[model samples]
Target: MVDHMIILLRSISAFVILLIITRFLGKQTLSNMNFHEFVTAVILGAIAANFAFNEKMQVIHLLISLAVFTFTSYLLSIIIVKNRKFRMWTEGTPTILIEGGKILEDNLKKNHLTLDTLNQMLRQKDIFDYSEIEYALLEINGKISVMKKKEYHNVTLKDLKKGSKDLGNFPIELIMDGQLLEGNLKVNNIPPEWVMDKLTARGKQLDDVFYAVKGSNGQLYIDFYNDKITHPIDIE
Candidate 1:
């Protein structure tokens, strides 16, 4: 086996190099690898794969190459962020694949996309047909995001003139795994005698219960192990 210390140092160096390189490449590089970036990434991965264990492939060379790639990506991002024209040239804006129920065939073909794929995505999003879509945009990362006209949107309680109901507060567990929770019982203003009396009246032993959670509505749910069944009980 290789020395654990050397392996750890190499791993740490690899991680640092990856972090620097990733930051330099900008968010777009990780989001969707464009054609040229994709090929460059494949080559980089191939080169880095062998460097992990090869005795000749020094860590310094790995760091240098990674730094160079990272710097190139960082500089490009700065230019793209500062210059609108350059940004538009380097990173194309989102295209409206379908607008007002009409599909833009030209943009679709340009992006090497098909109506079948678009329809598949639409259906996955619960949209039955293209007519139901008001706008469908081909985002920069090549993902299709669809928006439906307000009329076709799902209905809410407000739309039906019936407001939503309130969901009550969180439940508290007063008894769990056959153990009495003194703090919880005290916090909820219930005496220990009340719990003991309730269980005794129901002909159930305190230790017989597997778990129990209490609600603000004054209802106590008790569960027992299936193997320990065959018992008589009574409760309010």
Candidate 2:
């Protein structure tokens, strides 16, 4: 019972220390989580776990270890923010995965990514066809930033003149994962009958749709569960 109380106290101390240290590190460390931050997190977690469970270890020694790691990480983060060269060396540079609609095979191999994984990431950005991408960069945070060709670019307000329909507004979600958001339709003054009519015109039913939205241009867009891509690129 005495040992259990000591363990409980140690666990609480570890949690409190971790929370304080992480909070001081700032949200960027939590959000972006570059290579250094990732390492720091893993090491911190290991130390905290040991501090919590290893009853034989001295509390002062564990606390010192935590403090040293946190201070070094925090200092390095400051240096990284101020020094561009240091930041590049630590976090690495963005790799161009796709350029001029051409996939960089060598770059993919260097990054240890397969063609299948690249395709899946592209699909997540609603880009099934790589030909539409002018440039695709793999960011340091493991996100792919894509720029589509000029011909395939979305029309912006700058491209339009005065008295145009509201193109500034984003598309409103009407259906998601085959579930209709009736509240959205009611708020937008859209009738359920109108939605059914549009679906019927497209030879689709609610059960068949994976997602549906009302575009800012007053057009109904529907995506079905079955992608129906006859020739899928399956180069794993």
Which pairs in model 1 have colliding backbones? none
Q: Estimate each model's TM-score.
A: 0.54, 0.67
Across 56-122, the per-residue lDDT of candidate 2 in tens digits comes to 8888998999999999999999998766568879999888899889999999999999999999999
- Listed per model in order, the count of residue pairs whose N, CA or C atoms clash below 3 Å is 0, 0
- Tell me the lDDT of model 1 at 57: 80
In model 1, which regions exceed 4 Å deviation? 1-12, 23-44, 53-58, 155-236
Q: How accurate is candidate 1 locally (lDDT)?
A: 0.69
Among all candidates shown, the one with the greatest lDDT: 2
lDDT of 1 by residue, 1-236 (tens): 56666666676666565666666576667877654466556656654554555556876777677666556656766775566557657767778788778899998899888888888878878887777777888877677788776557667878589743322323557665577878878887878787778778878888877677775345777776444557757452
Q: What TM-score does model 2 achieve against the real structure?
A: 0.67
Error of 1 at 165 (Å): 26
Considering summed lDDT, which 10 consecutive residues are worst modelled in model 2?
162-171
How does each model score on lDDT?
0.69, 0.86
